[model samples]
Target: MQDIRCGSCSRKLGEGEFISLTIKCPRCKTMNTLRVTRSEPVCPSASPIGVSIEQTHHPVDRRQTSYG
Candidate 1:
């Protein structure tokens, strides 16, 4: 499973909630609207198969998120 964090507060996101959530940060109390995206890069090397996941958080309009 991938780990996601809050962009504003840097807190790890709750399990099973990756799309978007308008919630208050437990540590900082900052109201954050989070957008989570997961990306995997393609490596051309043929030695051994390796996997890497890139997660990015952006504060986007809530209406654009899947939650909306």
Candidate 2:
């Protein structure tokens, strides 16, 4: 991966949470993770792959709730 300057701030997004991110210019720090569209030369005829996952884990309060 190449070091890219933030399009908005022109600062190097070289710190935490910035490395190897695919969406949202790493420095400007936006919330949205955008979908990467296909362009010629880089990615030809992009085939998309997506997955839906549901995870269940015990909450911090492991005590039984009335609802449960």
Candidate 3:
């Protein structure tokens, strides 16, 4: 609920900027690769990165195949 601002420029980030960035803290002005909390997905928004989806299916394919 807080506006994450750019410390060096003192620019209060707008909503579009906030969603694009990953880090939010005072020292971010000078620091690089700060560990930021994973952001929760907004309604009707894209999912997080590095997520793998696994799909499981029954033995239907094996049963349908005939001997060759």
Clashing pairs in 3: none
Candidate 2 lDDT by residue in tens digits, 12-54: 5443423124334444454222122323453555553543222
Instruction: Summing lDDT over every window of 10 consecutive residues in candidate 1, give the lowest-scoring window.
Output: 48-57
Model 3 has an lDDT value of 0.37
TM agreement with the true structure for every prediction? 0.36, 0.24, 0.23
Which parts of model 1 are misplaced by more than 4 Å?
36-68
Lowest summed lDDT window (length 10), candidate 2? 51-60
RMSD of each: 9.0, 12.7, 20.2
Question: RMSD in angstroms, candidate 3?
Answer: 20.2
By lDDT rank, best first, the candidates go 1, 2, 3
Residue pairs in clash, model 1: none
lDDT per residue for candidate 1 within 7-46, as digits (tens), equals: 6768875655456556665665556665545444455444
Candidate order by TM-score, decreasing, is 1, 2, 3
Q: Mind giving the per-residue lDDT tens digits that candidate 3 earns over 1-68?
A: 54555544444543332223433334333221212345456655767544332222122122455688
* Residue 7 shift from truth in candidate 2, angstroms: 1.6
The lDDT per prediction is 0.55, 0.38, 0.37
